[model samples]
Target: MSEYYGTTVEDIFKTQNKRFRAEGSEGVDAVFAYDVQGEGGGRWKLTIKDGACATEKLDSDDFGEYSVKITVDAETFVGVTIGKIDGTEAFTAGKLKVDGQIPLMMELPKLFTKYAPPGKEVTAADILATSESRFQPENAEGLDITVGYNLAGDGGGQWTAVIKDGTCKLEEGLRDNLTVCNIVKAKDFVDLMLGKLDPIVAFGAGRLRLVGDMEIAQRLPKIFSKFKSNASEPVEELIMLKKIISVDMKYSTGPTMGKFLNGLKEKKILANVCPKCGRKQLPPRECCAVCRCDVDEFVEVGPEGIVTYCDIIYYASPDPLTGETRETPYGALFVLLDGCKDREALWHLLKKEDLVDVKRGDRVRPVWVENPTGSVYDIIYFEKVR
Candidate 1:
């Protein structure tokens, strides 16, 4: 039969028993007639009484006594039945004509749930097309095997899946040297893939016949993910939280950090030198970590430095100072300043435009603000010294 939007005119009437709601027809007695014109269209009658429904296809022009009659072209008729076109809009646009009781016809939609076109039948071609993507190379490691499928009946085709050394390749038509072969009807294979039929049950019932290696047949599940039906599934609304939390707090920068920020106002990098071991702290520390000696000597490092490491940040977090997120694809750099050595890399931001061109050991200089505040953000960011 010809179809429109994957559904034929006869398909709508054929699904009446499956879509009927007896409870909705309580205390209702009516006959609904449909006169669909054009190719692939016909007249049908629906009688509802005593919480039951009876459907009939009329061969003659007689509609008998219908409480309501609807007339429309085949395309619009199917469109309205499957909810592709709004019934109210179709009537208003003169695409649909109604006669008899208007009040009874208004209750038609409530009598049954909305119609959906039955999903297209899954075929061997469809399942095999997705086999490579669903293959689990980790499970197939160190294994070499050829699996052949000989699906019979409609929508069936021969295919071979070859798995070797952590990779899978699918070939059309069966191979003679298959390690294992599966023989089943195309419908059963589709049902098995959809989890609608059990392999154990089909095999026990002689519906599935296996040839060649038996162990390899059992290992098929481990080599591939479960086939997901392309049919539409119901979706539920997802819960979401939309808010930006702003915290108000402050802490005093002690002597060590205060001195470091003060140096940025003059476009200088400061470091504290440990007297005992001579370890340089880029952001000045009060005491040496290794030597356990109190550090007091301050040294000016570099406004220019070579990058020791760099991170191209794509996902950015909110800036604590501004309470806003930075634009992405920015670079965070760890620079070894001129006067500092031996792992004394200072952490700082890099210019966004220079992220792609900058690399380790590339010299960079801090771009200072016009009017500097004694904050780390005073220097906008370091730019690569091209």
Candidate 2:
């Protein structure tokens, strides 16, 4: 089918303009242009003039009066428009490249209607059962690999994709399922396809597990493209959907631990040292795991430590604490405090810039907020020492 059903781009703009007007034209007067390539490749611009929207197909890269411009493949543009791809996530993922007014580009999603490409009811079985049909032989070119999906639920069903010399055939149940298997809840499989969930975070959180042939699992992203479906407004959860749960919490911090929390206000690192094992616990564990004795000796270790392990979080769901998500491309790390040994480590955040330079054994320190609070939030996060 013609992308967006032939001659529909302008119709989309008209509809978008109506939506913008209803929302009282949130942005300043400006021209927004999309330089699209691939399948439905073309240049189009939507201009906001005196609170009204206008559109036209452009003939060149000469930006003209446009203040914000983005260039992306026709497929990705359609995915973004249809809500299969979150606009901000696509930009961050480098699928959408932009120049000129960034703030305006960021506002475009809110100015227009969120569209869902026709098939919103995609289920886990539908995705796996149709694997052979959904397969792009060209992408599988020069490669042969079998993939298996172990999805759980009422939609629960086993599926297998047998690939040989750039061709794929499907099966209803597992056969060599462990060749390269993915185990996930049927619902999460739906969210993964719909862009409501981030795969990297899912893997990190153990919600999605891949066993055997990890390299093949990583290739999954490139081998398949966006699925075509229905057109409707995107949901309020176009970004990341998370539940806001509130509860009362209380914890017992006896005399020993209480002193440590009080010392945080004075900017001291109080680690409980186990005399028997000579290991220090930064959070001040009541007892050492190795020695099996109460940690009585307090030793000051660090507002600084060395990174022992880290991973880049390119995508993730909302933070459970604040009900909000942090910007992507941040790092999650394990740091070993100075003067601390026996593999005792503290986990925290790292900056994007430091991610490239910081490595195992590289020193880091914590960033703190204005007022000192006994809770963990007293220190904002960790950063590279240099």
Candidate 3:
């Protein structure tokens, strides 16, 4: 039996349970019958219950009413499952035939995660050979450097990339006086080249060791194009629209929040003190959540505080205030200000430059604007106090 893209018809069915999305299967009760033809093909019944799925192989005796029944060749079934062939195109070409409910069959892809074949292991030699081919001469103008790779462990060997005069050449073994030498395991080197491992994370984790000029190491990615896998298939590009929809709106801040925003103009981080329990509300709420008592007295907390929690946001959507998208990788920090008690942490942004070094218990001070605004935007963000 032949396989399509390293995936057999049986392989696709066997891994269906692992790929099944329980969340998507909620309230979905249906049976899907697959009558795959050709070698390595067989009849199978996939039954989905409330947040669960089960697959049973059928013999010549088994035949039951199903919500949807699909008939296709083994190779086409495997190809479509792994995204190598388009299912809609196959159906139009009469290679794939469907019976029973068409809408249920159309929504089948959402019921389970996309099937991914176990890819062929990429070797270091395969990556090193493409150095010259993947080099971008346009980005390498006036560049002269030797990047040494002292890869160790299985399938490991020394190699050097001599980049000079708008060209790059891969050479076997390392040479003396290298600009930057990278010491890492061969498996990690392969993952790093494939972008499976982030270079910053690997460096911080000590999995990747770099010596000599650090600046050139950062520029290497720009000097070379990304490496492509030999066994990978082309993916369908998704259509995306960049549009900003703006709506003008305003709301009354009320007495509690009004004082809070007004205090920002005086460089104050105000929190309302509860008259009963003494628990402070970071944004100066009208009532204390614990004691249910009115909070009228407000006190200043901190322009500087210690971070209780930090998150480096990589995929930030457009800001609601400005309707403009921020740059990639910004920090969202929850800070425990000096005068604030437990559960009274103020939520704010941290400086982008400080994200790499910021951790819990780290001291941070707010970086305010020249002219204070009567809003939370008075301070741009917080930065680590050196």
Candidate 4:
């Protein structure tokens, strides 16, 4: 029984279906073929049946036969499996490539259990302690930048990576007149260093703060080596946290909303005109959010409208009520009706051929259901108006 730390694609595939089962929990179905380039790199196919995954080495590497073909180096494959580099980040960085079934490939995380290699807590200090080794001399060959890091907490401290002409030196203390600063928590910084946290997501979410040149901040990840955690601490007495927040809620919809619902039964879209601002609101509300006055007058808006924005959802959980997974990449449309005033928009699904080539300001007409009950689904979905 060998340990899991010596990460190899072949070694990992051999031990599956025993300790853990991959239940394609995201309702994805595909056969994934891996095409690696490097020493001992070879072709392998992973069949994801419903939610379960099983792997086999392919004798002939014909990528066109598989549902998806992923291309990467041998190290990246090992790195991805061991959590040193995230697949999405790798793809974004152009270190990894996927030939087909991209959405299915995105569901790869469900096919493998998170295996934490056995090791002691490699602190953030231990990682940054050898920061010089992580820096790339080539990237910063003639670059001069001072980056200050402040990781606050019990196990946190300030450190700086000062680079000059391609050489980066790590100091445990603060450095003055820095080019940029990144302030993060100790645990989060360690996670980010180990590829457990995506820098892109972190920066997007404001977890990783940048004070100065963002371009210099962007260059740091590429120049540095990825930190690998030796062992992941197991959860002992880990409470399965849950809380049920039940709210018994109902909306009266007032006279304005009530009239709007009535209009819906007759297959009409209505809006309320505000007295103060003269603003029109669709799916009429009692009072306008913009104007503090009552919206007394009602008028019909769009039987045909323009799409303001649309999202083509490729993957998401199955519908709770229907227990049905939709054939994905469906368009969720936000439409501004023909007669609507200002920026108020209604939500609807864009169906049929309308799903293709949908863009902003594309004209759409509601497809009403036959003899509809006053449900919102009465207009089942909207379609492109030719």
Candidate 5:
């Protein structure tokens, strides 16, 4: 039996779990050290104590303060730290060197269990099964979605997804409303599912591309953020990544916007008509300084429209409502309603390619969901009638 600081890793994990279970406590005063091997013959020290973890250069003066020391062969340490093995596997590989308390070392597994990664090898069948087990009325209330992956990265791979309230049965080489894409690798696919990569980043970086539902790209981040890992990764590199792209989409909506949303539920399109030029606005407004009139009329607009402009979407958000980000290249169109004039365009999903025949005056009709609630979303969007 070896020791870690004055304890064993396994024992530490057990004690921590017991304490957490009984008293909802984390570690009180504990310190453990690891000699990690780098890509070269280099090594580093990773220390955790009093619920804080840190990494340092191998030969620093900080080594004197560690309470427990675990030395391992350099190669083994690198593999373990980089997620190549479990604690037990590392020990069995003759790569672990524990010096402290054997009892604490024995508890290492229990502690690691608390920080376990999400399950590996989640197949399409596995996700479908989980969806079935967790099926609820609320989950089925919104849109019906299908997800697929092209693990080959060549965009010529089989795709699978779980459908809500519908069976994904392929008949005569046709699937019902199935969306597909050319994915290159499973890791990239999983990153998309986990919302780690934005649709734009994935496509622009040559990771993934969309074959359908470009709006799903914008909604994917919101959906995947719900399942984000509780653990935090080292931010040294990530912070630099953030600096390169400085746009964040999660903005707060105040009480005024809340009122406007309520009005949309009543099937009224509220606009902030400019008093100066008498221009009917699209998004609602509070004041009109040009004419200095408070435009508060809840106007009823037509459910028919024409496509004025459109763009493709291939990105994900961190919000949980939208599931994993879809592949790149879905259509978003700025629609001009039949009865509204003066830049009154509604932004919503359009099931068309950017290179399609749609232009400034394509006829379109609002595709309303059953039992409209008057919310702007009450009508999904206007689709080209032809």
Candidate 6:
């Protein structure tokens, strides 16, 4: 038997979990190696302390506290391993194993930079270049469009542009033939492409400049909004058709829900039940929609529940906190807790396989957190009774 004692992947995960729970630190020191079949492979030496990780290309002298060395076939490394890097299958398949403190291993997801598809940046650049190229035509379709100003870098200047017969062109004296149909700073344009800004504010606040017909400038917002919606479409065909563009729109950050999330870290389940219908709400709310009454009474729920339904998410959302999509699918379920006889249930993410086998009427309990916060996110989720 391979006796992985104090320095094993499982131990690393466990220790990291304890450290995170006890001190809220996701720090560790580790060495990891990916053997890329016959071509060439390298190792990564990582040092993590005080919740920060510094990694470097490894050498023979590079030995660390925790280590993972994976050797697989060359074809497997190129096809399977790389694919697993894009998804969470490597961890699930045991192809990617960790050796060291288990708790720190668990924190790896938070520490590591996720891999992103390479083409997005190129697509954004292409969109800008293509638009600029198309707008630099002179005397097209007899449109008397004129560029009133030619200010480069910040796009701050007045320009007089005209439109004729459904065609627009920039006037002479303007360096570029394109009149500003919509004005946006270069930075704001990048932010808009990354889903970090709103179009209305970008234009209204003068962060984006507008020229030519006011009607065209006004219609740009609607057009850009539709363009954004089309860009977000998941269909491969639609994605190829929709060119990526940049804009300047700032997104306001909502209040941090960290404390509420930390409550879940403590393993406490907090929920609100409807007084009239007796429906249990997982994310405890102040008002019950069905009963239209204030749910003043808070109650403790379970660490267990049945997996009602779930969907695998491979795509990333605009929400920044979600980070990168994990390779393993996170299971979400609507669990009916024990002692809540009113058929009321709370929904949350499930962390264990026992939850997968859970059926109706299965006994469940809440894994309560040590410290209680008066928030619904205090309870991570319920686990099934043994």
Return the top candidate by TM-score: 4
Please name the candidate that would achieve the greatest lDDT relative to the true structure. 3
lDDT of 4 by residue, 1-386 (tens): 22324556666556554424555445556788888778657788877676566677877777546788889878787788787888778876888887766656545554666554434667788988877987878777778889898988767899999888778888887788889888988888888887789988987898878888889887877778776665655556545554555677796766777888778899998888888887778777878787677778988888999999898875545665444667666889889998774577888898957777889989999999888666688898999978
lDDT of each residue in 163-205, candidate 5, tens digit only: 4553332112224465543345656655555567675788898
Q: 22-47 in candidate 3: lDDT tens per residue?
A: 88877788999999999889999999
User: Which residue ranges in model 3 land beyond 4 Å of their true spot?
Assistant: 1-6, 18-31, 48-52, 58-68, 82-86, 100-123, 138-147, 162-167, 171-181, 187-386
Task: Return model 4's CA RMSD, one decimal.
Answer: 16.8
Q: In every candidate, how many clashes are there? A: 0, 7, 0, 5, 54, 50
Model 4 accuracy (lDDT, Cα): 0.77
Q: What TM-score would each prediction reach against the true structure?
A: 0.43, 0.49, 0.44, 0.54, 0.32, 0.30
Ranking of all predicted structures according to lDDT, beginning with the best and ending with the worst: 3, 1, 4, 2, 5, 6
- Superposed Cα deviation of residue 124, candidate 3 (Å): 3.9
Candidates' lDDT values, in order?
0.86, 0.75, 0.87, 0.77, 0.52, 0.47
Candidate 2 wrongly placed segments (more than 4 Å): 1-11, 24-33, 45-57, 62-70, 83-94, 97-110, 114-260, 274-279, 286-297, 310-332, 349-356, 365-386
The parts of candidate 4 lying over 4 Å away from their true place are 1-6, 22-41, 47-54, 63-80, 84-113, 116-255, 315-326
Q: What is the lDDT of residue 19 in candidate 4?
A: 28
Model 3: lDDT to the true structure: 0.87
Superior by TM-score: candidate 2 or candidate 4: 4
Question: Across residues 1-386, which tens digit of lDDT does each residue of candidate 2 receive?
Answer: 23643233444544555566536465468888888877657788888867677777778777677787888887777777766668878888898987776556545655665643343466776666566667787877877777888899867778888888888888778885356988999999878877889999899999999988888788877676665444343456646564667798997898778878877777677888788868778788788888888888887877788888998885566667753556766898888877877577878888677877778878889888788887666767788876
Least well predicted 10-residue stretch by lDDT in candidate 4: 1-10
